[model samples]
Structure formats: C-alpha cells, structure tokens
Target: MDKRRVVVTGVGAVTPLGNDAETTWNNLITGVSGIGPLTRVNADDFPAKVAAEVKEFDPTDFMEKKDARKMDRFAQFAVAASIMAVKDSGLDINEENSEQVGVWIGSGIGGMETFENQYQNFLNKGYRRVSPFFVPMLIPDMAAGQVSITLGARGVNSCTVTACATGTNSIGDAFKVIQRGDALAMVTGGAEAPITNMSVAGFCANTALSTNPDPKTACRPFDADRDGFILGEGAGIVVLEELEHALARGAHIYAEIVGYGSTGDAYHITAPAPGGEGGARAMKMAINDGGLKPEEIDYINAHGTSTAYNDKFETAAIKEIFADHATRLAISSTKSMTGHLLGAAGGIEAIISVLSIKEGIIPPTINYVTSDPECDLDYVPNEARKQDVTAAMSNSLGFGGHNATIVFKKYN
Candidate 1:
C-alpha cells in the first residue's frame, strides 16, 4: 500500500511584480523590486510608508464584474490565480471527474480592507448600511470557498490558517491529501490583502514594519541595514495533480513536492524561539521526510523577513540543520524583491523554488548592501545566478511561532 505521488503541473501568481507566473518569474530573475511607496492607504498616516501591491490589476479580467464584486480582494486574487493554474494545467473539470478535484487556499488576514470599510460604514451610517457579503468576504476560508465554487471543485475543499505559513501549510496539506488518495488534482496556495488602516497601524504599533521610505531598499533581507519587514499583498497558486493523472493527461510537470514539515515554537506569540530551535526542527523534519541527505539540497528560499531576530535566528537554524552544508547551498530571499507577502509569501516562494528547479536558475536577494555577522551565508545577492538546482527547499516562519518547510525536487 504505497502512498500516491503528487507533482506540480501548473503555477500561477498575482503579485506586485506581475499578474501572472511568467511575468513575475521574469522580474524576479532580472532582480526587479516590485515594492513601492504605499499608495492604497494614505502614506501620511503611518510611519512605515511602503508596500508591495499588485499593480494595474483588473478583477474583471479574471472574473465577471458582478461575481468579483461579492468577493474580497484576497479572494479575488485567489480565484484569478486558481483559474490561471487550472487553465495552465489544461485540466478539464467536467462532471465526470469534477468531484475528484479540490481547492485549499489560505490567508493570514483576509479582507482587512473590507473589514475596515464595512466597519466605517457601520459607524457612519448604520448596521443596515453594511453589505451582507461582509462576513463571507472577511473570513480567511473564503479564498478556498470562492475558488471551489468558481472552479467547480467538489473534493475536500479546505483552508489552512497558519499566519505567515498559511501558504506553505496549505500546499503541504494539499500534497498530503493527494498523496493519501483523497483527490486526483488540487488547486492550492495562499492569498492576502492586508494593507489597511488597522493593519498598518497594528504592525506600526508593534514596530514590525520597515521604516525605510525608499521601497527599493526597504526590504533588505539578510542585510545588516534591514530594520523590519515591509507589508505586501497578492496571491500564489499551483495546480497539483496525482503523478499518474498528470502523466496520463500529458501535463507539464514543473516540479515534485517530496517533503513537508511543520512545527510550533510554543515559546512566544510573535517572536521565534531562542536560536530558532523550532525552525531547525521543521527543517530537519522536511529533509528527513524527503529521504535526502542535507548535502543534497542545492538551494534554500529563506524566510528572511528582514527583521533583526528572524534574520539572525533563521541563519542559526539553517546552520544547525544543514551543518557543514550551510555554506555550500545557495540561499536567497525573494522578499528582498517582493516584500513580505505575509501568508502568501510561502506560496509565491514555493512557486519560485519549483521554477528554479525547472529552469536551472536561482533568483537573487536584492538590496544586500551590507553584511550581517550573525547572518553569514551565500545569499545569491544582487543578481540571479544560473545554477542547475537539483533540489530546493522553501521555509516559512509565521507569527505565533509557526514554522513550515516544503521540499521540491527536479522531476527526473
């Protein structure tokens, strides 16, 4: 009774860099930063005034205007990315096998913009003025719900809410579902639209956001000058199919997800455990689950959040888990370009890891001007490198001390 094998057949993304996967991947490879001055919200209101926002996005381009109206921006991004992924996979969700398809999309904070607006409406007007779609749009699970309804996926519809690790956990859980024979194919990832007055004020109050006014250099992950993470918004999705199902359909396999590991610090509400012990365990679990030696890892897409504690702790965690191989593996933080997408960070980073395996190139960690003594590693800095990556790992550490890692291998 061997477990099933799951492979990524298609990828899609809606990020500040691009509206689709190819565009985003190209920008990432070219070392372009999508973060810019915060415009969606008034910059004058907050000390931290920059964000990575999906630019020039037209919801009607992906869904009917009326249909899009009911969904929060987060769910809209999810649905759009899901449609692209499913279409890219050439999956025909007909009645014959529609019931065998599932959708699992996660969001760290869903519809904060909607929540703020609806609350204001309630305050200014009355309870009667609030739209009925408020609750549906504000819940984190609505991304999965909307994707399922739009794609007609009837199997095991679900969502994971692991704060910043939501995307990785969602994808990991989807992999398990398919591996255990729960579905033939799945649309899974994470979405977020967290830029709002309350969201900004909350992070500002905690001093968790970067104070840098220049968007280009604000999110310098792994750099000594990095102050804190810059908020970002968007979505990333992948069409995961049973190996046999994808093979039978002649679908293009981007990469195979071979391992998933998750752990909790149980030490803090916001900070990682001392020395990133929990993250180390999650990394070890993922490596072991993949049945690979630590030295075999070619690259790491780090959860380098640009926060002082995270940068130092994650570096220590990597050294502890990878041992001598820490210096050998090429590591980078795409957040240097895309800003921290919160829950959606892992989703897009996972896509980038798969693309790295498929394309033989590793994206760079831009804005690496200065070095940090505690964070010493070969962060593919300033420029993308051409490397024949055989195996790649993506790490996502969230608030509440949640840590998750997912391993991807070149589909040989």
Candidate 2:
C-alpha cells in the first residue's frame, strides 16, 4: 500500500540561542554562539566551564507557578514547547477527534535536576526526605506523558530513548504512525535539561565536553583543533499532520516529511562505528524512502557534534553514502551555535531543515577556521548561504550506536 503523505505544520523551540522558532532560526542564520561561561550552576571548579544554556526562560509564562514547581525542568520545557507547537498547528481538537492526535517526545537524560536534588535530599536527610513526586519527575517518558496530558491527546502516545537519537527517533516514529494510518496528527519532538552537576561531572569525566574558555569557539564542528562537544539545554517540538487532514484544515505547510531511516552500529558505547557505516545505511535508507536519487538532496544538516571522532566519521559516512553528490551537498553543522542539545539535537535540526526548505537558505557551520583534511566536503563554513534547497536531510547519531536520518522536501 502507498504511504499517506505527512507535513510539518508547526514548530516550537527553547534553545540556548533563543526561545521560539523565529528567534532560533534568526540566530542560527547569523551564526550566533549560545555557549558561554556556565551561569546556571557553579562551574568554576569543573573542567568544562562553558555551556550553551537557555537564557531568560520562565516556566510560569507557560505553566502555572505551582504546577511548574512540581514538574522537572525537562518536563516543563516539553509541556511549554508542546503548547506552542499545538497552537502553531491551529488544530483545535475537541473531544470528537482527540483520539486521532498523538504525542511522541523524547529526552536523553530525563529530569537530571530532579534526580540530583532528590538524591541530595536522600543523602542529607535520609530516604524519608525524598519527595513523593520523585518517580513522576524522573522518568524518561514523562515528557511524552505530560505533553499528551496537556493536550488531551490519546492516540498512540509514546517516547523513544535512543540516547542522542531520541528526538529524531521520536519524530520519525510519529511520522510513520501517520503514514501507516495509525494516527492523523502527532505532536512530536525532543526535550533536554541535562545541565545539572551530575551530568556535567559525568560528561567531564568522559571528556565529552569542551574545556575551551571561549564560548564562541568552543563548539567547532569540522574545524581543526576541536576538543569536544559543548552541552546545550533546550526543547524542540514540531506538529506533524497527515496531508489530507492538514489540507482539509488549511494548515500552513513548512515542509513535507518524505523519508525516515534508523540503524545501529553495535559498536562502542560512547563512540560512533568505524567509518560511520551504520550512519551511511540510515542515510541511504532515507533517500530510498524518499524515492529520490542521492543527487537530488541538496543539503545535509550533519550531526556534527564538534567532537574529533564524530566530525571525521560523519564526514566519511556522507562521502561513502552520497559519493560524488557529497561534493555538491551544502553540508553544515549548526551545532557550532546551538551546541549539542543531546536528544533534542534531532528535533531542532529537523526544524532547521524545514526552515532551510521554506527560506531557501542554509545555516552555516561556524568556527571553521582551519578545515580538517579528512572532512573535505563543502561545509558552508562560517557563513550562511542562499540556495534553492529542493530537498534536505538531517542526521542524528546517538551514544550506544544508534543512528537516525530523516529527509524533507520542499512542497510543490
């Protein structure tokens, strides 16, 4: 059977650069750096002092003060962004068709703040001092559950937890649900709030975070002399609707979700597979799913985490998958500005892909001072470029060897 068409009707994000889609897109195009000295917590003693933190965020603006107090920061961000995304979609579902609407959002590490605080309370005042809401606040599925509750969506609610690939997998799974006639509309995306002390300490212990003192140059994706990724905190949510449902309601279309592919390398826990073979398979599968030739894809929103291995391996994967078309593709790693949002990387990057299709411009991979010989692709380095993007692809490779790719196309 032929698959039903799906379209992105709405987008919402709370990023290190800015909150909301417009501001994030603007900052991304202008090559702004969201990373800075860690102000959310005392990072003076930590090895990595810089991070891409969301600024001026008030949960009260999106939720009741009392309610926001109860929820963890990740859940708060998920609920808030979902509200914005649903509003953007303009799909005012009542009790009549509410069952057709679903929610699928993900996070890599759920409620790190909650875990830290509660664990600290346990350590200080014993186990009796732990809050009753501990379990509710700390589960990875809370983001999806809370968003569903907030929107009263009852259809096919689920969460995907593939480490950094969580967000992309969630969105891609939701897309398949609509395509398979499982649901007509889905609120799908990723949220992350893992900037806690434990998270920092863990990443630092693994040497996964950048120790650069300068925020602007911390996340240098594909650049020579890159150290590691800069942790970013935020949420990105998108409203996806079945084509007929969206057209019937006259919802504005940002872009069409044409293809999605996911694979696992079964390699190391923290590193990508050698040569990114798993990632290449996912890319090829996405292209095949789109029913388009590799040459038709004009841009690639790389999962360039600014880490030495990820940049080199991802570049190799693109070369292997696209071959000569890799040379023509305007590849870029917007992580230069947004840093690594972990699970939310795929969601925001997918939004960036849609925006590129809608705006006909590609965001740059900033801080590309010296190029790596191994990464020889046209990275669209350091500056945004204007081009007619007919089709675009976004890649997300997670810890535990998970890799996912989704393809988007400009609607005719």
Candidate 3:
C-alpha cells in the first residue's frame, strides 16, 4: 500500500511565553524572554536561580475542576493543550469517527511534584496517606493517556519518552500512524511539569543547568559566553490530519509533515556523540525521507540547548549535513526565549517551524551575542527575520542519545 500524506491542521501550547500557541509564537517572533526567577521551588536552595515557568495557568480553564484534581500538573498541561488543539482543528470525535482519531503525547519527566508530595506523605504519615491517583499521576505515559481519555480519542493512544526528544518523537510516530492509514487524525505533541525540587536538583547536580541569576540573558544559545540550559516546563500539542481527510472537512492546513527521521547516538548517555555524528545522520535521513535536496530546507528550529557541547556539536552536525548550504540556512533556537521545555521543546518548536512556513517569518534565537568560532552559522539572532520559508525542519536531541528530526513544508 502507498503511504498517505499528512498535514498539520492545528496547534496549541502552554509555555513559559504564553498559555496558547499564537501567543507563544508572537512572543517568540518578537524576541521576548520568558525566563524569570525560579519561584516554583525556592531559588536560593539551588544553583539554578531562573526558569521558564507557565504563569497564571488555571487548569479549570481547560478541564473540569473534578477531573483536573485527579491529574498532575503535567497531565493538566497535556489536557489543556489537547483541548485547545482539538478545538482548533475542528475534528469532532463522534461514535462513528472516534476510532479513527488517536493521541500520542509524551513527557521527559512526569509529575515530579506529585511524586515528591506523595513520597513525603508516605514517609511522614503512612501508606494510606498516598492518594490512589499517585501511581497514575507519576508515570510518564499518563499525559498521553489522560489526553486520550479527555478527548475521547480511541485509536492508538500512546506516548514516547526520549528525554528532550519526547515531543518530536511522539509527533513523528503519530505522523507515521496516519501515513500508514491506521488513523485519520492524531492529537500529538509533548508536555512536562518538571519545575519541582527534585528535577531542579538533579539537573543542578549534573551541572546541566545554567547558574546565571539573570533570567533575561541566561539561555544564550550558540553564544560564546553561554553557560548551560535554563530549566523550563509546559506543553505543546498539534492536530495532524491526513491530507484527504483534512481537505474533505475544509480544515485549515498549517503545513505538510513530509518526513520524519529518528536515530540514536549509542555513544553516550548524557552527552551527544563526538562531532554530532548521530545528529548529522538524522538530518540526512529526514531530508532523504522527504525526497528533498539539502538546499531546499529554508529554516531550522535547532535543538540549541545553550549547553557548551550541544551548541557546538549541533553546529557541526548542520555543517556536516548541509555543507555549503548550511551557511545559507537560517537556523535559530527558540529555546533562547522559551528556555528548555525538556520533552515539550520539540512540540512547541514543531509548531514554530510550521508557523514559519505558513507566515513566511522565521523566529529568532534571542539573547545571542558574542558568536563562537565553532558555531558560525547564520542564527537569525536577537530579532525575527521576514523570509519566504518554503520548508522548515525542527531538530530535537535528547539525553539518552536520542535524535529526532521532522520536516514541514508549506502547503500548496
């Protein structure tokens, strides 16, 4: 059987920049920094003093009060974003079509706050003090599960947990599901609420997070003075529909998801492979999967985590894959503004990539200054660029050597 074409119809997000997709994209293009003083957990207790946290979010806005209570913050984010995405897509899930709809949301870390609270309760009180919802809330797959339950999507409910690449991998898998004719539409992306004490301490212990106190200038990806990534939390969700299915309903198509590539470094656990060999392969595979030449890609939403190795190695990977065309590609990391949304990074970044093709504007890598010799690509720095982006690619590299890339093309 031939593979069906897939297109992104709708997108939604709850991020440090805003509560919805458009707001986040606006902030991203305007070069706004969403990082602020870490308040979710006491800042003084940890070396990382700043974070990109979702502010003024009330779960009741998206779900019922009773249902929201049963879910952790991460699940709440997933449900909120999913509800928004489904509404945006106008894909009604009735009894006849419910089985044709699916959900695949992922998280790098799920319910860290819930785990900490439940463990403290167990230690202080007894086993009975633990809530029955603890187990469901603590697991990483619960975000996908809860979104499916809330949205009444009965087909292919699943999750992918590849650290920071969770969002991209989940979306890629969902694209495959639709291409294979298993589902007509899928609500897929990633979510995380990892601002809890344990998550902060773990990253700090590994020296993976920036110790910079000023939130405005902390996450400066590809900059010479960059320290490390800023911890962040939020969710990003998108509604992907088969081309004929979407056209039949007259749904607004954002961009066509033409290719997906996933690879593993297998060289390290926390560090990327030497010279980003795995990343270069993933990019090559994605371009080949799309049957496009390297020069056809107009923009790249890079997984520039601002960490020393990540920025340098990702630059190397781009050069290795694109060669002369690398210099012409307008690569930018929205992580500079949104911080590192961990697993949800790819989800929001994918949304941004689609928007870039649709709007003909590339979002900038804000906070970039003092360029590094190792990273000498044209990072649309500090300000958004107006360009006719025909095709865009988003890259996500996770801690466990997981590398995923998804390509989006302007729908004709």
Candidate 4:
C-alpha cells in the first residue's frame, strides 16, 4: 500500500525568545540570545546562574481564568500553542470533523511545580488537602489530554515520553498515524515548563547545567570553551495534515515531512553512546527513509546541546553518517541562543527547520567565538546566512540515549 504524504500546515511556538513562531523566528535569525539571569529560582543556591525562560505569557489570553488554573504551566503552554496552531491552519475542529483530528503532545517532566506543591500539601495537611486536579495536572500526558479536550478532538490522543526526545518522537509518531490513515489531521508538538526548583536542583546535582555566570555565553554550542547546556522552557506546536485533506481545505503548507528515524544508545542513562553511534544510525535511517542521499541535504538543524560530550559526539556522528557531505552542509544549532528546551527542543527545532525550507535561510549558532577541533563543520556561526535550502534535517538526542531525526523538504 502506498503511504499518504504528510505536510505541516501551521506552526506555533512559545519560546525563550518569543511567544509566537514569527516573533521567535525573527529573534532567531537576528542572532538574539534569550538566556538571562536565572530568576525563577534563586541563583545563589545553585552553580548554574542562567536560563532561557519564556517571557510575558498570559494564559488568560488563550483560556478562561478558571480553565487556565486547572492546568499546569506546561499544559497551559500546550493548549495555548495548539490553539494558535489550529487557528493558523484555518482548520475547524467542528462536531463534523472533530473526531478525525487527533492530538499528540509530550513533555520531559510534567509539572514539577505541581508535584512539589501538592506533595508538600499532602505531607503537611494530608491527602484531603491536595487539590482534586492534582493527578491530572501533574501527569506528563496532561499536555496531550488538555489539548484534545480544548480542541474537542476524539480520534487518537496520545503522548510520547522519551525524555528529551519526547517532542520530536511524538510528532514523528503522529506523522506515521496520518501516513497509515489513522487520522486526517493531527495537532502535534512538545511542551515544557522545567524552570522549577526540583528540575533545577536535579540538573544541577547531575552537573549537566552550565556554571557560567553570564547569560549571553552560557550556551555556546560547539565552542571550545563550552561547558554544558543551559536549561530552558517553552512549547512548540504544529498542525500536520494529510496532503489531500490539506489541499482540499486549501491550507498553506509550510513543508513536507518525508522521513523519521529514531534509535536508542543503550549505553548510558545520561550520556550519548561512544562517538554517537546511535545518533549516526538514526541520521542515516532518516536519509534512507526519505529516499535521499546525504549530498542532497542542504542543511542540518543539529542537536548540539552545548555539553562537552554531546557537541563532540554529535559532530562525530554527523561526519560518520554524511562523510564528506558533512563538510559541505550548512549546519547550526539554534540552541546556542534558545538554550536547551529538553523535551520541547525537538518541536521548536523542527519548526526552525521547516521555516528554513519555507524562507530559504538558515539560523545560526551564535556565540561561536572559538571552534573546537572535534567539531569541524560549517556551523553557520554567529550570523544568519541566505541559502536556498531545498531539504533540511532536524535532530533531537535525549538523555536516555533516545535519538530521533526527521527530514523536511520544501513543499513543491
């Protein structure tokens, strides 16, 4: 049986840079850094003093005050972004077609603040003191559930939880659902609000966060002086539609998602495999799945997390998979400015890749003042470049050795 093609019709993002896709993309191409002094938590308590935090977001703008309070911050973001995405697609989730529109959203850690607060309430006051919405608000699947409820979609509602690979994996899964004729249209993406006390303490305890005091230089991916990734929070949502359905609705297609690849390192819990072997295979698989050669890929939105091992090993993986073509590819990590969104990284990076195809330009890896010998690629450093990008790849590598890659092409 022939597979149905999947196309991205609308995208929405609430990032450290901005609250909407257009705002974030504008800041991204202009080489802006969203990292700032860690304000959500007391910086004096931890070694890491900086983070990329979403700014000026008001849930009441998207949802009713009562409805907003029932959701955790992550769920609020997912619902808000999905609302924007669906609106952008101009696809109505009416009673007639609502059942055909599904929702798949994911998160790394679902409501750390909710868990912490409710746990304290339980410990101090007892189980009766906990809010009735505790379980629903604290679960990672709430993002998907809330989105489905908000949009009134009923066909397939699921969430993928693969650590940092959650967002990309979820989107890829939704794409397969459409390709397999499970649904006509899908609301898919990832969301996170990880700037909580427990999350910070956890990453700090693991020493996976940058200790840099300066916000601008905290997340310098592939740079020689890079230390580790900076924590960030945000959500990215996209409306994916089957080619015929989208065309029948005359929706504006951003790009076509042609291939998806995922793999597990099976080596360590918090580290990538030696030389990123798993990641390399995933990249190769995506290219093969797309029926394209490495030489045909114009650009790569790298999973360069700015960590010592991640940047080095990911660079090695790219070279191994693409060979000489890696040198010719215009590769860059937008995480250099956005910091690491963890689970949400895949969604936003996927959007960046799609926008690059639509606009024929590539965002840059800012703060690349010095290069590392191990990471020898054209990392489109510091400044955005004008390039006619026909095909692009977006990669996401999670802590559990989960590696996912998706290939996107200009909608011709």
Candidate 5:
C-alpha cells in the first residue's frame, strides 16, 4: 500500500521569546534572547541564575478558569497552544471529523510544581490535604489528554516521554500515524513547565544547567566558553494533516514532513554516545527516509544545548554524516535564544525549521562571540540570514541516549 503524505498546516507556541507562534518567530529571527534572571524559582537557591520563562501567560485566555485550575502549567500550555494551532489550521473538529483527528503531545518533566506542592501538602497536612487532581495534573500524558478533551479530538491520544527527545519523537510518531492512514489529522508537539524548585535543584545538583550570572550570554551554543543549557519552559503545537485531506479543506500548508528517524545510543544514561554515533545514524536514517542526499539539506536546527559534550559530539555527528557539505549547511541553535525547552525543544525547533523554509530565513544562534574548534561549522551566528531553503532537518538528543531527527521540505 502507498503511504500517505503529511504536511504541517499550522503551528503555535508558548515560549520564552513569545506566547504565540508569530511573535515567537519574529523574536527568534530578530535574535532576541529570552533568557532572563531566574525568577520562576529563587535564583539564590541554586547555582543556575538564569532561565527562559514564558511571561504574562494567562490560562484563561485560552480556556475557562475552572478548567484551567484543574490542569498543571504544562497541560495549560498544551491546551493553549493546541487551540491556537487548530484555529490557525482552520481544521474544524466537528462530530463528523472529530473521530478522524488525534492528539499526541510529550513532556520531559510534567508538573514539577504540582508534585512539589502536593508532596508538601502530604508531608505537612497528611495525604488528605492533597488535591484530588494531583495525580492527573502531575502525570506527563495529561497534556495530550487535556488537549483531546478540549478540542474534541478522539481518534488517537498518546504522549512520548523520551526526556528531551519527547517532542521530536511525538511529532515523528504522529507523522507516521497519518502516513499509515491511522488518522486524517493530528495535533502534536511537546510541553514543559519545569522551572520549579525541585527541577532547578535537581539540574543544579547534576551540574547540567549553566551557572552563568549574566542572562544575556548564559546560553552560547557552539561557543568555546559555553557551559550548559539554560532551563526553559513552554509548549509548541502543530496541526498535521494528510495531503489530500488538507487540500480538500483548503488548509494552509507550511511544509511537508518527509521523514523521521529515531535511535538509542545504548552507550550511557546521561551522556550521548561518543562522537554522537547514534546521532549520526539517526540523521542518516532521516535523510534516507526522505529519499534525499545529505547535500540536499539546506538548514539544520541543531540540538546544540550549549553543553560541552553535546555541541562537540553533535558537530562530529554532522560531519560524519554530511562530510564536506556540513560546512556549507546553515546550522543554528535556537536554544541560544529560547534556552533549552527540554522536551519542548524539538517541538518549537520544528516550528522554527518550518518557518525557515516558509520564510526563507534562518534564525541565528545568538551570543556566539567565540567559536569552538570541535564545532567548526557555519553556525549562522548572531544574525538571521535570508536564503531560499528547500529542505531542513531538526534534531534532538535526550539524556537517555534517545536521538530523533525529522526532515521537512517545501510543500511544492
């Protein structure tokens, strides 16, 4: 049987850069840094002093206050972004079509704030004082559940939890669902609200977050002075529909999702495989799945977390796969501006990748004053570049050695 083609119809985002997709994309291309003094949790409590936090987001703007109260922040973001995406796509989810639509969202850490608050309630005032909604709110899958309930999408509801690769894997899996004729349309992405006390403390304990005091330069991906990622929170949602289905409804298509590849390093729990061997394979697989050669890829939204090993190894992986074309490819890490959204990183980065192709502009890796020898590629540093992009690749490598890659091409 012939596989169906999938295209991104709409995108929505709640990020440190902005609340909506257009605002986020505008801020991104302007090289804005959303990293600011860590305010979600008291910065003095931890070594990491900066964070990329979504600001001035009112949940009631998207859902009822009563419904919003039952959800954690991550779920709230998912619902809000999903609503925006559905609205943007102009995909009606009426009774006739509701059963043909699905939802799949993922998260790295779900409801850290909810868990901490409820656990405190349990410790101080006994389990009886805990909110009955604690279990539902604290679980990662509630994002997908809440979105489905809110949007009335009933076909398939699922979530992927592969650490930072959650969003990438979720979108990739959703793409397959459409390709295999499981659903006509899908709402999928990743969400996270992990700037809570415990989340920060845990990352600080593991030294996985940057301790840089300055907010402007905290996350300098591919730079020699880079330390680690800046913790971030948000959600990115996209509406994906089958090609014929999208065309029948006259839905606006952003880009065609052509390929997806996922792999496990099996080398370490925290660190990526040396030289990003697994990452290399994932990239190769995605390109192969897309029926494209390495040189055909015009841009790469790198999973450059600004960490010592990630940038170096990811660079190595690209060279291993693309060789000389690696230098010609316009690569950039939006994390330098939005910080690391962890699981949501891939989702939002996927949006950026699509926008890059649609707008023919590459968002830059900001604050790249110094270059690292190990990361010697054209990083499209400091300023956005305008170029016609035919195809783009987005990558995500998670702590569990999960490597995911997705390829997108101009719809035409």
Candidate 6:
C-alpha cells in the first residue's frame, strides 16, 4: 500500500516579530530583528542581556481573561496559535469527525516562567501560596492537551520532547500518523516560554547564550563574529490535513509535507556529534523519504545557533550531504532575526519553508557582517531574495544530540 498524502492547510505563529502568521512572514521577508533588551526580568548582571521576546501579546485576545490567568505563558501561546490555526484551516471538528482529529504540540522546556515564579512564591511566602495549577501549567504535554480540549480534537494526542528538536519531531510524528491512515487531521507545532530567571541562569551558566549587549548584533549565525545564541520565545502552529480531506473541503493549501527524519547523536549531552554526522544522517533520511534528489532542494533553514561548534559542524554537514549541490542551494538561518526559539525554532522555520514554497521568496539571515571560510554558503546573506523554490528543508539540532529534518515540496 502507498503512504497517504498530507498537506498543510493553515499556519499560525506568535513570534517575537509578529503576533500572527501573515505579519510574521511579512516581517521575516523584510529582514526585521525581534531581539531587544530583556524586559521580563532585570538583567543587570547577566552577560547576554537581550532576547527575542514576544511583544504586544495578550492571551485574553484569544481566550477569556479568567481562563488565560490559569495557563502558563507556554500554554497561553499554544492556545492562541492553535485558535488561529483552527480558524485558518476552517476545521470545525464537530459531531461528525471529532474523533478523527488530533493535536500534537511540543516544547523543549515548558513553563520555565511558571516554575520560577512558583518557586519564588514558595520561598517568599510559603508552600501554601503556590497555585494549585502548578503541575499542569509546567508540564510539557499540557500544550497538546489544552489544544485538544480547545478544539474538541479526540484523535491521538501527544507531545514530543526532544530538546530543541521537539517541535520538528512532533510535526513529523503527526505526519506519520496521518500517512499511516491513523487520522485525518492533526493540529501540530511547537511553543515555548523559557524567558525566566532560572532559564536564563541555567543557559548562562552553561555559556550557551550570546554575551553581546546589542540585541541587533547578537545571534549572528554563520558569521565569524558570532559568540553564542540568544534566547527567544514564541509559538508556531500548523493545521495539517489529509490531502483528500483538504481538497474535499476546499481548504487553502500552503504546501505539502513530504519528508521527515529524526536522529540522535548518542555522543553528547549538549553538543552535536563530531562534524554533525547525526545531522547529516537526518537530512539524508529526509531527502530519501521525500524521494527527491539532492539537486531538487532549493532552500534550507539552517539550525545555525550562532555558537562556534554548531556553525562549523552544521555547515560541514550540509556541504558533505549535498556535495556540489551545497553551493547551488540557498540557505539561511532565520534565527538571526528571531533568535533561537528553542523547541519552537523548527515549528516557525517549517512554516517559513512552506511559505517559501508557496510565495517564491527566501528570507535572509541578518547580522551577517563577516563570513567564515568553513561556514561558506549563500545564506541568502542580509537580504530577502526572489526565487522559485521547488523544495525547502528546515533543520533543527538540539542538546542531548537530537537532530531532526523536515522537507517541504511545492505542490505541483
């Protein structure tokens, strides 16, 4: 039997650049950096004082005020983006097909803000002062559970927690569910709200964050001057439907999800495998799964974290995997603008990949002042470009040696 076809019908995002998918895409094309001085807490002592924090976000805009108060910032972003995705997909899972719809959202570290706040409350006041919703709010799976309840999706509901690769794994697993004829629809993506003191301290202690004070100059992926990644927060959700289901309903089709591959380095707790062997395998698996030749790939949204090791290794992996085609492909790291959204990085980058397939525009990697010889590639360098992208892939590499790659093809 042949695998079932899957298509994306709707895309939604709450990013540092915009509150909605359209606005975010627009900002991405225009080369806007969302990173700024950290405002969620006092960053007087931290070396990396800037991040890509979401702006002008009000959970009450999508849900009731009372209900919003009960949710962590991560869950709040999940609910908000899911609502937009459902509305955009025009998928009303009512009495007819409620059982056939599913929700799968992932997060690397969920509700860090909540954990910090509740711990502070416990220390300052008492254990009794902590809210009863603490556990549910901090759990990573809450995003999927809340989204299922919000839209009445009764199909397979779960969350993938693969560090920064969480979002890509979630969407890939959901796509497999549909391809195997297990479900008809899945609301899947990633969300994260890890901009808290503990989160900052943990990353800073590990020396994973960029110490650059100027937010605009920070997160310089693939650049010789890049020091480290800047933390970011956001949510990105996509409504994926069976091809027949979407066509039957006349839903808007953004692009088709053709390939997904995931791998583990099994070599490190916080670094990629030597020379990105795991990452190369993931990309090769994705291309094979998509049944596309290396030459068919037109663009790549790199997992360039602006760290020294990642930039060098990921660049090497791409060149090794694609060989001569490496130079022919247009690749860039949108993290240069949005900073690193952690688990949500793959989610929004996947959305951008689909849009590039549909709109024929490639977003740029800003803040690229100087180039490294080892990290040589087009990188769409500093400006958006107009091109007919036939196929696009997004790569996400995370701590714990997790690597995932998803390929999107222009629906012909």
Regions more than 4 Å wrong, model 3 = none
Error of model 5, residue 22, in angstroms: 0.3
lDDT (Cα, tens digit) per residue for candidate 6, span 349-407? 98999999999999999998898998988898899999999899999999999999999
Model 5: residue 292 alpha-carbon error in angstroms: 0.8
**lDDT, residue 289, model 2:** 94
For candidate 1, report its TM-score. 0.99
Candidate 1: pairs in clash: none
Q: Model 1 over residues 161-233: C-alpha lDDT tens digits? A: 9999999999999999999998999999999999888999999999999999998889999999999998999
**What ranges in model 2 sit over 4 Å off?**
none
Q: What are the per-residue Cα lDDT tens digits for candidate 5 across 177-213? A: 9999999999999999999999999999989999999
**What lDDT score goes with residue 46 in model 2?**
92
Q: Which pairs of residues clash in candidate 5, taking residues 3 or more apart in a chain or in different chains?
A: none
Give the Cα lDDT of each candidate.
0.93, 0.92, 0.94, 0.93, 0.96, 0.92
TM-score of each: 0.99, 0.99, 0.99, 0.99, 0.99, 0.99
In terms of lDDT, which candidate is strongest? 5
Looking at candidate 4, what is the lDDT of residue 90?
Answer: 92
Residue 224 in candidate 5 has what lDDT? Answer: 99
- Cα RMSD of all models vs. native, in order, equals 0.7, 0.8, 0.6, 0.8, 0.6, 0.8
**lDDT score of residue 391 within candidate 1:** 95
The local lDDT score (0 to 100) that residue 91 gets in candidate 5 is 95
Q: Model 2: per-residue lDDT, tens digit, 1-412?
A: 9899999999999999888888999999998888888977788769998998999999988878988877899889898888988898898877988999999999999999999999999999999999999999999899999888878999999989999898889999999999999999999999999999989999999999999989878889998889999999899999999999999989999999999999999889999999999999999999999899999999999999989999999999999988888898999999999989999999999999999999999999999999789988999999999999999999999999999999999986
Candidate 6 has an lDDT of: 0.92
Q: Where does candidate 1 stray beyond 4 Å?
A: none
Greater-lDDT candidate between 5 and 6: 5
lDDT of 2: 0.92
Clashes of 6: 0
